[model samples]
Structures are given as C-alpha cells and as structure tokens.
Target: MKKNKNLLEVPNINSSDAQLKKIIYKVEDNIFNRFFNSFSKSEYLCVCSGGTTSSCARDNFITLDLRKEYDHIHLEKEKNLIKIGGGVIMKDLMNFLGSQNKIFPTGLSKLPGAGYLLTGGISPLSRRYGLAIDNIETIKGYLGNGTFISLEKNNLSSDQKLLWEGFKGAAPFLAIITEIGLKTFQAHPIQIIEGFINDNELSKIINLAEGFPENLSLQWIYAQDIYIYILAEIRNDLDKEITKKYLNKLENFSSLKIKTYENYNQINFFPKELDLFELNKNNHSEVISLLGEDLKERIQIFIKCMKEIIRSKPNNSCYVASQQLGGKTKEIDPKSSFFIHRKSTWKPWIYASWKKDDLKEKEIVLNWMNESWEKLKIFFPKIHLAQIHNHLNSHEEEVYLSFEERLSELKTLKNICDPESILPPL
Candidate 1:
C-alpha cells in the first residue's frame, strides 16, 4: 500500500516522461482491483482536485492528487463544447473561455472543476442556462472498481443511463471524474450592481428579484451589515433594454446603495488573490437552505434568524449569503439528473470560520451554525450537496435530502459501481 503523503508534487498526466506514464497507467489498472480483493483495509485512496472546497482532500486517506496530473482545458468552438480536466480551477477555466468568447455555468470562479459538477453546480448564470449538470454532454472517469467508464446521455444503456443520472448530482460517490464535456454559450459583457441593504429592506428586493428576467442574477452576502451584489448579462445587443428594465426594479429598495459596472469580468465577483478555501482552512462550517417560491413570504424571518446568529457568533468572520436559483434551473426535466430541488428560488447558506487549534471557538461556531440551521430549515427544507457534502459532516441522510425520492435509486446505482466503497461515504 502507498504511504499517506502529500501528492501535490506529482507531475501532470500529459508529461513527456515515459517512466511516469508507465507508472500512472499501472497504478490506474490495479488500484481498484487491489481494494476489492484485499483483506486489509488499512489504507484507502481518495482523489484530490486542488482541495479547493473539499474537506475530503485534507483527510487521512491516501491522496491521489489530480491537480498536477490532469489540468487540461480544450475548447471546440465549432461544436460549442468544451472538455475540461477535473483538476482545472474555475479561474483558469473562465479566463480560457472568456478569451474564446464563450462561457459555461460555473457557480463561482474559485471553485475546483470535478467537485463543482459532482455536487450539482449552481451557477450565477444558472437562472438562464440552468445548473452546470444540465450543460454536461459527457463525463469520462474511473469507477471505484478500477473500471474505466465513459458516459453520454444518447449512448447509454438502461443501467448505464441510471448511473449517468446519479453521476450528474452525486458523482463523488460513484467515480473519480477525469474530464467533462459541457455545452457552452456565447460570451457577453456583464453589468454589475453592488451595494448594502438593511434586513428590513431584504424582503422587497427578494420580491423584485423573484420576477427578474433570465439575463439577471442576484447574489448577496450578509455580514455584520448586509451587502447586495447583482450581475446582469446581455446575451445579445438587443437584450440591453430588457436588462435595464430589470435593473430598474431594484430602485424600489430606497435603502439599497447601488453602483453599476459595465463589461465586468465575472471573476471579479470574488476577491482577487484570495483563496476562499484557504481562508477557511482551519475551522469552517457552512449550512445550506434551499428556499422555494414561498421565500417571498419568509424572507424577513430568515434574515432575522441570521441576524440573531451573527449577534451571538464568536467572531466577525462568519456571515449569511444567498444565490438566486429559479429561472431556467426549474425548467429541467425531473428525470435528467439527481438534482431534485429545481423549484427553489434561493439557496441561502451560513458560513463560519475560525483559527486552527482553537477547539473552543470551533465548537461555539459549529453550535451556532447548527442552531441557526434548525430554525431556518423550516423555511428552506432542502439542501444543495455541492455546498455541503459528506466531507463536511453531511451524512447519507442529509445528502439524500437533496435528492428526495430519488435517493434509493441513486444508492442502488452506487452499489453497482462502487461495491467495495472505495470513494468517500455519501
């Protein structure tokens, strides 16, 4: 068995070194077989893709780091498809797509590749183009039993089709995705409006946003004070007037201080030179709430609960944030994937971070987060696995809540593909 050590130094899979290529091919062929046939379970392999937002990457399992091995990004403009390596980071992917005048629905610019798709990626553009899973045409990866698998919707058998559906939302449990082929859209300049608003004014903004057009997306981060951010993209020159009409709706919130930026880079939505995963490296916990259209009525109550939690928080680093989710996201066919919370209008999440080795602070923040979740969950019952999975204390029950009735079907598919349970527990 390979000893547990940092796999960061491993070279890319495309390296010219003949010796390394031979070693990687040999490892790939026998790794899964060994796990299935071996009596000793002393060591297990866990795949890593830069460890950007996954707690699994930091665990004690022997790491199979893909960041150095499979970071390729290829664009096929004529076909409107892009094939991205699992190890590619969102920043690099977005920049490459931008240069080619194309775009894919990746929720955040800082997120890693595979985890984003495996967890049912909810993007800023999801309101228009649908979730990232909806854009996937094919996924090439290795099943837990060391068998290589290539999946595409049109070419799958009945059983493979079932596995494909599960792969769309719960892929981390079934396979280690190596590359993904996704549909792309024409790139357009974005108009950004950002500002602050009080909790009382949050309701009015939510009402206005509920009726927003497909071109606009609303996102907000509520810290000690609530800060609002909006991104409106014009797919064509003709859509500018419609975009302006939507922006005008926000004027109703008098307390909202807003500023507009034309032709902004979507990446600028996050802080430059900051690694969000690194910021929460020590002790961090996040609870998600998938709020439906009823959110219009419960918006104030939700904000109030978050305020109370913030007031009692151990530190100022923790906050409440949400992303708009309805538009095209709800229009996807129910049988297409395991992402079942299609009717949800907003995905609100609570994030808390503390210093390393500060067990007291960690306990306090986790308790506060869990308490707040209990109160807020009644308003938004569903959870998005992409934001919270097994690595972050999420169990099979909680993870299955995101899939609802489809959980059993997904589990059967998991049993067939990963009988030895080589992947993380879901």
Candidate 2:
C-alpha cells in the first residue's frame, strides 16, 4: 500500500505516546480530528459515509472520527479474506478490490466509507449480489473496554443467529466494530449507461426505469421535471442487448440525451484504489435532500420542487439520483445486520452541497429539500421497504427518532465495545 500524500501515515500501535503525538501532528485536520475524537468520547456519535450522521452527532452527542482510530484491516492472503479496519474509506477499499479485479457492493457514490456500508449500506451493486454486510463472513469489534473478539459465519449458531438477526438495520448496540472479515470476489465486468431526458418527455423516463432488467439498475433524477438523469449499471451479457434496448426506448422521448459507457469495467477496473478523502472531501456546490417514489409522477413532482430550489441557488452543481431497494436487496432476510430498512427504501439520494460561507444559499436549498420531503409524505407511504438516512430532512428527522429501539441497541453495543466511548457511535 502506498502512503497518502495529503495525510501523514499512522504508526503501528506499538509506538510511544510522544512519538505518536509527533506523527499525528502532521496529518490533515478532518482525519486528525476524527482520529483523536474517536477515543476522546466516553460516548460518541461515530460517523463514516453520509455527512448528516456527523452533523446530527455534533448537535446531539459527543462525536469523533472513527476513520482513523477504529477502522483496521488485516488481509489474510492465504485465507482469501481481509479483516477490514472500521475506518477504511470507500474509494480505498473499492480501488483495492479493483486492483484484484474483485468487487463488493457500494453505494451510489464512489466515495462512501466501508464502515458505514457494511453496517447499513445501500449500494448500486447491492440489488443483485447483496447489501454490503450481506456478503460479510465475520465481524470483529468490542463489547467494551477495548477487548477484541471476532464474529465468524460459524458463530451463527441457531441461538446466536437470533441475537445477530435482531441487530441489523438498527444502530449498533453492545459492541463497537474494530474490524470486519469480508468475503471478496473476483472482478465482474460491468458497464455504465446514463440517460438524460428532456423536460416534456418525462413520462418515458419512468417507463424506462420500470422496464430495466433484473441485472440492470437505473436511477432517474428530475430537476424541476426539466432536467432528469437516469444512470444504470448492467452486468455482463445478461441481456447482451439491453444496451440497445434502453437506448431505443429512451429515444422515443423528445429531446433525450444519453451516454452509454460500454465496458465500464475497463474504465473503472477493480482495485483502482483511489483515495476516498480526495473524492468525498470536495463537497458539491449544492445538495438538498428530496424524497420521491421510484415512479415517474413522484419524480416529476420532486423535480418541479427542485427546479424552484436550484434556480435560486445556481451554484448548486449536482443532485444525487438513485433507484434504491429493488432486486435481491429486498429479498435478503430482513433479520441480517446487512439489511436496514424499517419501511420502503427509496432510490439513492439526490445530494447537493455548497461552500462553507453560503449560509443563506444553504438555508434556501436545505429548506427546499425539507419541503420536498414533507410534500412527498403522502406518496412515500406507498413504499413498503425503508426510507434512507439522508432524506430524513427536518420533518423526516422526527420520523427517524421512531427507530430508537434499534438505535438504542446499537448504542449499547458502543458502550460495551468502547466503554470510554472512544470509538465512533452512530
């Protein structure tokens, strides 16, 4: 593994406090803050992928960066398994896997951390194979006091499986993850195809997604119903002809522009090992959360709302679009820690981010996202899976507090694992 240029390397655990202190002084602020913050909390809100968890933590409890302090990976080349450090970032792990021509499920963004995903993940590839933790072989962490233990597939005895089953989707309780032993795969060839629909041809957009194959996953984004983005991932030769099939169907819509990234694996090979901090660290100009049905009318309605929001904040560069919770993901036994939807799962988020100083603009976009969330509640009731964490805008926040039982369980795990609360807490 190569050293990241921007941050100094963390020394092996054997170093003296004086030496460790000197070494840590040279790293980046977020990473450093996160590293020290991990152990400082007698209780903490640990954060990984989505930024909101950290935001919420800062407001409610003591928080820290688990990315450095807790995330540890130990690769066993002979065993064909890697004990991943809890703090590992998404790009680093995916890129590492890419290098091996291997694959694991990942969220819409290439930058989310593995810590967040394996515990409660929703990835582009999750539909067919499984959610992040669905593929897990084992989990190793703490019940409390820095004592480490490993949970393996063999440990899923009838009695233990019952307890483990209860912990999925809910936050961690009774343990803090130090590392996870994950099942890895040889690379699967893939392709990326994107569709852009014109404002008027919106009906066809929904039709296209509805028609996507089991092997193909697509996301539709409506920007005031005027700008719609649909991104799809196609596995090798499932339909062999879906490429042309989708292209032709999309053409029926007026003013549609599409980009088909054939042989996408060739472009984004496994284990490419890109640095995560490099990617996620660059926040988008604008991100406002929205909720909508995977269906077209809901998307159109959301887009109309977004158009008004984006128009006011032109700097808002992009909105994340996803079709969440179809495929085998829904099929997975809801009991596994891998699956976490209390209700219907919407597609990936349409995330928007702006500069630090853009308070007024930020307020406008965030309010729009919240308003969009509230506006769509009636339609959302139709979804039977689970709502994602990010969409819990102002109103959604209250709704999420309902999951406290599960969350409380996760917190119990944290207390037991890092009684000092040094590890990241959800």
The clash count of every prediction, one per candidate, is 1, 51
TM-score per candidate, chains pooled: 0.87, 0.66
Number of the top lDDT candidate: 1
Q: Summarize candidate 1's per-residue lDDT along 1-426 as a digit string, tens digits.
A: 223223233222111111111122223677777555642353345565645443434333455666666788898878888888877777777788877777888775455657776777877888888998999898998887777988876699876888788888888878888888889888777777666678776767776787788878788777677667677787676668987776677677665454443333354654524222234434444455455454766767767777787787776667777888778988988788888887887887777666645778877877777776777777777877765445445455477668879888877877887877877655
Candidate 1 residues lying further than 4 Å off, grouped into runs, are 1-27, 35-44, 252-266, 272-291, 387-394
Candidate 2 wrong stretches, greater than 4 Å: 1-80, 144-147, 157-175, 221-236, 253-320, 338-345, 348-365, 381-426
Model 1: residue 396 alpha-carbon error in angstroms: 3.5
Pairs of residues at least 3 apart in sequence or in different chains that clash in candidate 1: 13-69
